[model samples]
Target: MSQPPKTQHASIPEPLAHPETRGIELIQATQRHGRARDLFPVWAAPNVSVLNFTVGASLILLGLELWQAFVVIIIGSLPWILTGIVATSGPAAGTSGSVITRAIYGIRGNRVVVAFFGWFISAVFLALNWLASSFMGAELLGQFGFTDPVLAPVLVTIVVAAVTVLVAVFGHGLILRSYPAVASVLLAIFLLVTAFVLPHAQWGYVAPEPLEGAPLWSAMTIGFAILASTPLSYTNSPDLARYLPESTKPSRIIAATALGGALPCIFFTAAGALMATGIDAVAMDLGIESALLALLPAWLGPIFVVGVIINTIALNGMTTYTASMAFQSIGVPIRRIPSAVVVGAIGTALTIYLVMSTSLLDAVNLMLQLLVLISGPTMAVFATDVILRRNRYSGAELFDEDPGSPFWYNGGWHVPGLLAVVLGAASASLFLTNPAWTGPIAAAMGLVDLSVPVSLLVTAGIYIALTRLAAKRRPGVLPAVENAAA
Candidate 1:
């Protein structure tokens, strides 16, 4: 492999004072800083939102008992381990996940994947989280008697979008420095929420007409898929971890990232499910925020609203940051700050449209469901590549777009990797069961959705087999197994 360029040391700036100037470029070893443990809050803060509560509530609405929902939540969280594994590539490669994927999918081929799965999906999530926060913000306003239905939502959305955009424009340094505090605040508020809601929970609550046989399994699988969507969407885990020093242990990174995300998601989502047991399912479905606010004392209502908005900013900021990076990685002409602004503007517009026209719960459910067909396979491919390559990545070579670059296989496309993603997504579609459409396999199997597992297995299997075969036939295509260690 060609040697990386000589290290160019850049002094770290005061994160609050200056915006981060780096885009999709590789971080030099000298410029790398931070510890794996720091990643905990970075991952945690985003998942600590009212949105996750809705996810739990949705599981209940899907006809599963409380225990079944808990089980599904835990199982869904397993993908965060894959997220952690993908994150290790960050420090080892010293570049954002979007950039590092150049090796797995080849330079040009990766651009398409990053543009669609990375950027587009991120933008949608940005909109979804923003919409969730705007609803809470408007409700908070209502608590103070500012309940102009139309005006309140517009004002709140604008402010929320602006704050989220500013954070994204500030970029990685600020995110690293601030997320710990954000996570702490959100956790504290939610803990209070839990304390209040726990007492009202119907622990042994059972569905009036409990589903049995194929129907029960179907509900469980669908619930698992819904909960899994959040973790699976985070292929950008490496985007935040790229600044960590190369010497950081992979195990630390894996544990920190996985636990940080899984713990809060499980807790908050379970809280949502618990809250639902006391709430009428119809009310919870119509407006989770309203239903939740009705349960809390008046004083806590505003506080909870504020917490939801803060959580939204944290979540949306992370999404915008990743989307900005994905845009740059797609060979966009604009720089990072402009890219962030563009993403924010798009998300804001989307939030307004959804608020004015669509049902929030329906949008959230459909978006999460549709995303799995792509996200599951995508994350699986990324994790599999990390293992097959043994975490060995050349940051500098990834930047080289020339045909001579080591990653420039078959005219800037690794046929096996691209083909694997296509076949995996296609296979996944066959087993997908969502409101919009039910897959053939799902229909045959009594409405059970197996897309999540099917996509992961097919994508990983194909990539591993094809990668090994290509490596055997072409010696330089992959690193020697003994020499390939991060």
Candidate 2:
């Protein structure tokens, strides 16, 4: 039972009947005038300056790297940079589970897997990040002699969630709008902070050897781990890209996104590695230590600490906010739940639990491990659907709940994509000689650590090959409306 063709209707209503056009509304008009039929008309425009993504992501990732192995994060992202290219240039046929089930598995069978893949991770990451922020806030602020540090941490979570919710509920336009400007400022402060620690960095403390074995793997893992943030950053991109003047080149968007992820990452890794060479305090251990006091005036330490906290919170906020949007996108086109409220409540809850067990350092490591495992295939699936299929989706028919629509629900399981991701993650995990995988692998013994770059490629290749084979056997399997013939 094939799905019906899409209606002529646009997802959102077209511009109201006024001769005059506003800024973005004007861009929508130009798109409607036959500029690009595929545009989805999201509120956030897709284009971002290279500086915006690089600085922001760099600050976040590097701060993380210094805590773990500075060396590992650098090595991990080496392959991730190439991987990012394969992602930003492409699009998914529909939100998660919807497109994969149709292409590989039959509509009904893969539904559970699709839903699990989509919601489980989105929910978990949102919960974890909220906790990480609140926990850090409680501990960092504890020095001020506040009574009940435990309860205070909960309030920090509330504040984080509230701010993020406000941003998300209003729509993600704020993120796209502020990324470039805010990124620049963040970068400048980051550099200033690093400069303060220049004298403290005893390069001699860094190993003369390139730090072999699992340590090497650990460093790479750190880089790969941070990839969790990439998809969240990009999930809202279609909204951003749709508004890009129809005349703007897609190549620019790809370049900017790639640069945005890569350059800052490298800078952060290098800088943090330098700091790692110098630090010693067990509590202040993650490189930004008392040395900072000697490096800068005493007053600046608190100011920088606050900045670091805010920067980290902002990055965490972005992740939490986007994760919520992704969850809502799957749940309801018009989710009644407010994003701010969700962020506040969830963030607070996560904060209390986080304080009980993990350190900021540990959470960063966990985030990378989980992110890469999911990210590799997520990007692969999206890229194959968009670039390989070309831009052809039935806006209204896709939303139809009918089982026949490839987009309605995927087959019971998308074996190709699943296998690909499995194979890819397995390869990275299997091939690695690192210490970290011991915990993840021991926990999910049969499961592959899909976060590795090796997993990403394996998954993508298998899925692509499988799709081609299916095409050869049954030419009619593809949706007539999508015309996804690359």
Candidate 3:
């Protein structure tokens, strides 16, 4: 990455003055003062929104009974346990997740991964949140007797996008400061939703009625696939954790993140499953906002709708911030603020297209399922790289654009890392199952999907074997940097 010409900003606040725009630069020690505990709110607040409810309802629609759905919801949440583990890499690397990829894949090679998987993942998430937020805000305004079918939704979409962009423009300090408040409010609103919906639930009304032929095996696979895709959904955790003190224990970070992400999702998804039973219509047909309105008491319904709007703000803000970082990693000349605006505009456009298109939900499901194909292999490659190197990386050299730097392998291509991603993604593609698309392997295996586990193992195993072989072929080909004992 080429260093930008430094420009001074005297008026900005200390915390928000994160003036360093270089994608690979280390976050200085002064900025590394956030606590490990803050990440709980950062992650938990977004899941506390209607997204979990929708996911819960989706599980039921996919053929799981209420009790079976609840069990799978809890089990599906297990993947989030890795959130804190991945967050720890931030402080150690002092860079955004995409920049850290240069350590695994060479700098140039990392761009292809970033463009198709990393940045595309962020944009897709932004679009999803943008649409949900806008939908909620439009509904809430309609409740206030401001219902205008054409103008209202458009206005709400604009407002939500504006708020997201402004928050993201300010960057790190605002994100850290806002999380606690967002989490508390969302938690309270969702609890009220649970209380009102549970008493109305028809516990024994397991649909003897036929909706679709989603088998038990297919339901479980889709459920697991949903959770597997979540890590990529909110890739900002590490970006936030990059500001945390290096001394924070990995265990504490992991615990806080796991609990914070898991509890709300489990609770709300269970509630949503119950809500699905009480309502006669399919959950998707009602949509989350309409379902909440139909199920919750009149007084709490508006409050829950408002909560969705707020939740989307928090989610999109972090998404924009993280995505801007990913964009810069693509060798863009833009700085943080400009990059944020550009990404926000793109997300907003996609959000509009999603709402206009009849295939929005199907497209979203397909993308989420495809996430396993992207993130699964990427995660495996990253884990293997860090473990083999024993966390030894020259942070400064990683930013160097010159030829001799360790990260600039074979004209900015790490052959083994590239090969690992290809092999892993190929295996993952073989197991994908979504409404829009199903993999050959998934079809052959009686519609069972095993993409996530299959991709991770293949990616890591191939990368390791290739690296070992390469090392033997040409002694001392890979550069060794002095390891940091920390």
**Which numbered prediction scores highest in lDDT against the true structure?**
1
Q: Candidate 2 lDDT (Cα, whole model)?
A: 0.45
CA lDDT, every prediction?
0.85, 0.45, 0.73
**Alpha-carbon TM-score of each model against the true structure:** 0.95, 0.70, 0.89
- lDDT, candidate 2, 1-486, per-residue tens: 322232333333233332111111112222322112122111111211111222223333333334344444445445433433333322222232233233433344334433555445545555555654454455456557764756766677667666655545443344544544556655666667667766666655534345455444444444544543344324333433433333334455555555555556556555655654555545244322333334566555556555444554455444444444433333334342353355446545655677566655555445545555555565555555555555443333334446555543343344555666566656555533223554355235333233445555676677678766656665555543134544
Number of colliding residue pairs in each model: 0, 35, 0
Candidate 3 ranges with C-alpha deviation above 4 Å: 1-24, 144-150, 209-214, 282-284, 359-364, 474-486
Q: For residues 1-486, what per-residue lDDT tens digits would candidate 3 score against the true structure?
A: 321212222123236555334444576545566567878888787778677777776677676788778777777777675566666667666678778778677889988878777767777888877777666667778878988754676677778889888888877777777778989998998898788888878888576643345467777888778766776344445677776655567777777777888888888878877877776666557466666677667787777877888888888888888888877787876788888888889888888777666333454456678777777777777766766665444445567756867677789888899999899999888887877678898898777888888887899899888877766665555533222111
What's the best-to-worst order under TM-score? 1, 3, 2
Off by over 4 Å in 1: 2-14, 480-486
**Model 3 residue 47 distance off true place after TM-score fit, in angstroms:** 2.0
